[model samples]
Target: MKILKLSYFVKLSIFLILPFLCFGQEKEQKEKPELDLGGALRFNYIYSSWKEEQKTKGGEFGYDMFRINAKASYKGIFLNAEYRLYSEAFGGGFLKQGWIGYKFNEKNQFHVGLVYVPFGIKQYNSHNWFFNITYYVGLEDDHDMGFKYLHEDEKWEYAFAFLKNAEELNFGGDTENNSSRYSYDVVGRNKETNQFNAKIVRKLGDSIQHRIGFSGQYGSLYNIDTNKNGNHYALALHYELNWNKWNLKTEIITVSHSPENKEGQSNKIIKMGAYGAPYEIAADFNMYTIGLSKKISVAWGPVSEIEVYNDFGYMQKKEKEFTDSFMNVTGLLLTAGQVYTYIDYAAGYNHSWLGGNFEDDFSTGNPDANWEARFNINIGYYF
Candidate 1:
C-alpha cells in the first residue's frame, strides 16, 4: 500500500480587513443608503426509486433551505449579504454570499469577502440539487474567502481571484449509511493558502452564441507540511443558443492535478468512505465533465417550462492501481409557478457520488458489473 503525505487566522483578517477599510472611506462621503430585502423559503422532497442496496427504495422529505438575502448601496459602495438554513447532504447552508463590492464603471468591478470562484458554467453544473460531479471536486458554489476583480463588456470578459482555504467549507462525511454526498473538497480537501484563479472569455456568434475561456489554478495544499504544494489547472468551453421560446446550453470542462509529498508525511487518513486510508496523492489525476441541456416553454397550465438534460463525467488517476470513475445522468426538470421539480435517472460506477455506495454494496461478485441505478424526484418550493 502506498501512503500519501498529508499536507488560517491571518486569512480572515485579510479577507475582511481591506474591504472594510474601503467601505469606511466611502461610507463617510455617501449621503444615503439604499436597502433591498428578499429571501426564499424552499422545501425539498426526494424519493429514491432504486439503488445498490439489494433492497427497498428510499425516500426523504423535509426543509431543503431557508434563505435570507439583503443588499445595500451608498454612493457606489455596495454590500450584499445572504445566509441559508438548509437541511441537505448534497449541499450546505451557510453564509452563502456576503461581500462588499465597488463598481468602477459599467464594465469593471471589485469585490471582497466570501464570493463565487467564477469557475465552470452555471447551468450545466447547477441542473439539480446534487450540482453535478464538479461540486464534489470543489468547482460548484465553491466560494472562498478572497478578493476578486471582474471586467465585462459586450464581447469579452476577464476575471481574477485570490483565494484562501480551498474546499474548507464542506458537507457530508458519513459513509455509514452509504449516503450519496456533496462536498467542498473531497479530492483535494485541504486548506490552500495561496490559491489564484484567472480566466479570460471571448463571445462568438450573434444569436447562436458560444463562449470559450482558458482558466488556470495555482495553489498549495497544506496540512502535513507547511511547505509541500499541490497544483492543478483546467480549460473550459461553454455554448449557448437561443431561439424564441427555447434555448440550448452545453459545457466541457477538463482538469488536471499533480500532488507532491515527502516520505513519512503520508500518515493522514481520508475522512470517509471505502477509499479512506493512508492517502498518498503523489500521482496525477485527470477528470472531465460534458453536459447538454435544453429548456423549452411548455404552456401546460401552470407549468412554465421544461428542461431536458444529460450529463456525463469521468475521472481516473494516472497510476494503474486506482479505479476509474464515471456517471451518466439524464433527466427532466419541470418548472411550475415558484416551484421546480427534477426527475432524473443516473447510471454509473458505484464510485459516483450521485449513485449508491457501490464499494460498500456489491450487486455482483465482480466489480465490472458494479453499475448502479438511481431514479429520483426532487421537488422544491420557493417563496
Candidate 2:
C-alpha cells in the first residue's frame, strides 16, 4: 500500500514533466530548458563478518534511485526541482531537493522551499558510500522545508536558513524498520520544528587551499512531558584541505538536547522500527570525523580515476550511561565518465546502524553486543 502511494506520485510527476521539458528540443531553442534526465541503476553484493546467516549478506540488483533534475529561468527568476525514487518501507518517490531562487547579484541569492542545511563540511561530503556520523545523526546533507539566504565569493561563503522541519514531504506512514530509504522516526526519538541553521566559512592561502568553517543549529523537539517545546542546539567546526592528489576533511561536532520521554518508562528504550534502544532524552554528545582521499589517474583502462578513501567517526554520548559507537569506512572507487564502481567495507557496533543501512543487526539472548563488519561491492551508472 505504501509503495502504491509513492509510485502513484512518482509516475504522475513523470507524466507531467516529460513533455514540458522535451517540448523545444528539436527546434531552435532560445534559452534551452536546462533539464537533466538521468538516474543511476545499481547492483550490490554484501557480506557480514559476524552474521554469516544475515539475509542481506548476498547479491541483489534493483532500482537504486531515479531522478529528474530540471531548472529553468527567465529574467532573474528561477525554479529548480529534483524528484527521486528510493525509500525503505515503500517505493519512495520524493524530492531530494527543490527550491526557487533569485540571484540578487553575483555573490548573493535568496531561495525558498526545500534547501540543504548549512551544517556539513561539504554538500556531499564523503567520498565513500557511508557518510560521516553527522549523517547518521540527521545532520549531514539534511534537506529541510524552509527559506534560505546563500552567498559565495572567492574567499568567503555563508548560509542561513529558517526551516520548519527536516524534509517537508516525508514518506507517508508509520515505519517500524530503520532504513536509509526512510527517515529515522523509527522509535520517534527525534521530532523537529522551527529549526534555524547558520554557517560561515573562509578560505586562506593561494596554492594549497586551507578552509575553515563554523556551523550551528537550534531547534525545537517535541516531547511528551509538556505541550511546550524542548530545546536542541548543535555546534560544529569543519576543516578541509587539498594539495596535490590528496585531500583531507575533518569535523568536530557537539550537540545537546532535552526532550520529554514516554511516561513511566523513562529509562527503557522504546523499540519500534529499530531493534536497538531509543535515545530521545536530555543528553549531550560529541562527534568527530576525519577522512583522507587520494586520487590516482589511470588512463589505460575503463578506469579514468582510481581513488582510495578512508573515514572514521566516533560518537561519545555524554549521558555517562550510554555507550560510545565507532564507525570506520574504507573504499576503493574507480570512476569512468559518469559511471562509478566501488568496493567498500564498514565495521561498527551491533544495532548501531552500519553500512548496510537497511539491515538492522539486532539479536536476542546471550548478550555481549560486539562490533560487526559489512563488505559490499557496488556498480552504478548514471544516464
Candidate 3:
C-alpha cells in the first residue's frame, strides 16, 4: 500500500513563489538609514568519559550560552532583537531573534518574526531555529511559524522554508534510554515531531560546492500518542582549494530517514516500519560521509596555520531490521592561534553527528557506541 502525497504544502509554496514571480521587478532607492547593533559573548567547558565492555560513566561541565542581539534599519524597513542566557539548572535560555524586514534588493528579502535558519556554515542545521533566553541549553528553543525567501547572488544560492510548530524540540539526550531490555523493544519512543524543510546551495566553478535538501516531520512520541511521521534528507558535495601557503578541503554527506508514517495522508494505511532499524531503527534510513581538511600558513613568527582533519562513515540496521551492521572511523586535529585570536588546539576520534553507527536508540532497540576524546582551548578577545 503506497499513497503518501500531500503536495507537501503545494510543493513548498510553489518553490517559494517562483523566485518571486521571476524576479518580481522592483527598482529605485534613494533613502538609507541605519542603526544595527551587535552582541556576542560565549564560554563553554565540557568533560566526558565512558567505557563499554566493562561499563563506566563520566562527566565534567561549565557553560555559558550567553548572547545579545540588536537591529534596526530604515529604508528597507528592518528591526531585530535577541536575548539569551543559560549557565545551568536544566539549561534554560530564550529569545534568540526578533524579526521585521523588507528588502527586494541585494538579491532579495522578506522576513517575519523570530528568525534564524541562516543555512549552513554549520551549527547542526543553521544553529537550530531560534530563541534568546540567555542561549538556553534545554534544546534549540522551539518557536517557529514561518516565512522565508532568500537569494544570494554571485554564483547562486537558494533557500525556501515554510515552517509550523505546535511542539517539537531536541537538544540531544533521549534516544530511547540508550539501549538494554532487548534494546528497548529494538529501539522505540522519543517522538514529538513536526517539520518541513528545504534547501539548496550551489557554487561549482571556483573551488566547488553543492548541496540538495529535504525535510518532513509530524509529531507524537514522548509520552506516546503514536501519530508519528518522519522523513529527512540530504545530498552533498564540496571542495575548497587555496595554494600559496597550502589549504585544501573536501566533503561528502548523504543521509536519509523515512518511517513512522502511521497512515498519514493514507491511501489504505501504509503503516511502514522494519527496514532493519539502523539510522535510528529505520522504516528506511541511509548514511554516507567523507571528509578531509588541511591548512598551513605561518612559516615563522606569530604562530599560525596548522590544521588537519579526517573522517569516515558507515552505519547499518536497514537490512529490513534483523540488525547487525555498523562502522565508524574518524580523526581530527586543529591549531589556529593568531588571527581570529584563538583555538590553539582541538582533537577528535569517532566524532559523531551521524558517524557513531546507529543506536541513537533507533526508536528503542538499544544500540550504543559513541566514542570521543576531544579537547579544545581558546582565550577569547575580539575588538
Cα-based lDDT for every prediction: 0.59, 0.67, 0.38
- How displaced is residue 88 in candidate 1, in Å? 8.0
Q: Best by TM-score, which number?
A: 2
On a 0 to 1 TM-score scale, where does candidate 2 land against the true structure?
A: 0.78
TM-score of each: 0.73, 0.78, 0.24
Q: Which stretches of candidate 1 lie over 4 Å from their true place?
A: 1-31, 49-58, 88-93, 122-126, 167-183, 186-189, 225-283, 356-369
Q: Write the per-residue lDDT of candidate 3 for residues 1-383, one digit (tens) a residue.
A: 12335567678889999877766533223345667655555443333233242123232334444566678788778887776665434235555456687888999887766544433222231111111111111111233445567777866666665544321223343443221110011124433234444445555544444443332223222322244444443344433444443333333333344444333432111121111232333333343333344556655565565554443333333444333222222322233342332231222222222234323333222334444332333222221
lDDT of 2 by residue, 281-367 (tens): 224678888889999998956778999999888776675545566778899898988888878897775335552223322211113
Q: Report residue 88 deviation for candidate 3 (angstroms).
A: 25
Instruction: For candidate 1, write residues 1-383 as lDDT tens digits.
Output: 12322214556667879999889878775657889987877554444434333234345556656778899998778998888765545344566668899999999999998877777664236465455655545555666678899999989988899987433334333111122222244232333457788877787777567676666666765533334565655556655555553445455566555444355534222212111211122124455666667788889998989988787766554545455666677888899998788888876674434444533211111244456656667776655
Runs of candidate 2 with Cα error greater than 4 angstroms are 1-33, 54-63, 87-91, 169-190, 265-283, 355-367
Q: Give one clash count per candidate, in the order shown.
A: 8, 3, 34
Return the TM-score for candidate 3, rounded to 2 decimals: 0.24
Arranged by lDDT, best first: 2, 1, 3
